[model samples]
Target: MEEISILLLFDVLVGLTLVWLAWQTLSSLDLFRAIVLFIAFGLLMALAWVRLNAPDVALAEATIGAGLTGALFLSALAQLSASTKRKDEENKIENS
Candidate 1:
């Protein structure tokens, strides 16, 4: 009985954290921060899947959902940052 209650409490906490992470990911103004939050949410989801006895889903979420997606987002961000830097350099050259 006590063990069950503790498990229930942990489940509720995990659910709440997932919800909070999702909200933060959506509402954040900084795109990079939002992406990071989204990755964290994915990890949390994987843990939730494990808790629910879905090992396959947990594996998928950890690998494709979190790992691959985070990598893609980071690469895209890098490209955008590089382009912005190039544009700034061009403007500086033109001004000089």
Candidate 2:
């Protein structure tokens, strides 16, 4: 009975943490911060899957959901920044 109660507490904590991280990710204004929080959320989601005895799903969530997706988001952000910088430089040159 004590072991069961401990497990229940752990489950509730993980679930609540997942919800909070998801909310933080969504409500974040900065794109980079949002993506970082999203990655953290994915990692916690993987932990929740592991606790649920779904190792395969946990692995997928950690790799694809957090790793690959975060990398893609960061790369896209870099490209966007570069493009915006180039456009700004072009505009400045034109104005000059």
**Best model number under lDDT:** 1
lDDT of 2: 0.96
**Model 1, residue pairs in steric clash:** none
How many residue-pair clashes does candidate 2 contain? 0
Runs of candidate 2 exceeding 4 Å displacement: none
The digit string of per-residue lDDT tens for model 2 on 48-89 reads 999999999999999999999999999999999899999999
Whole-model Cα lDDT per candidate?
0.97, 0.96
For every model shown, what is its TM-score relative to the native structure? 0.90, 0.91
Determine the C-alpha RMSD for candidate 2 after optimal superposition of all C-alphas.
Answer: 1.2
State each candidate's clash count.
0, 0
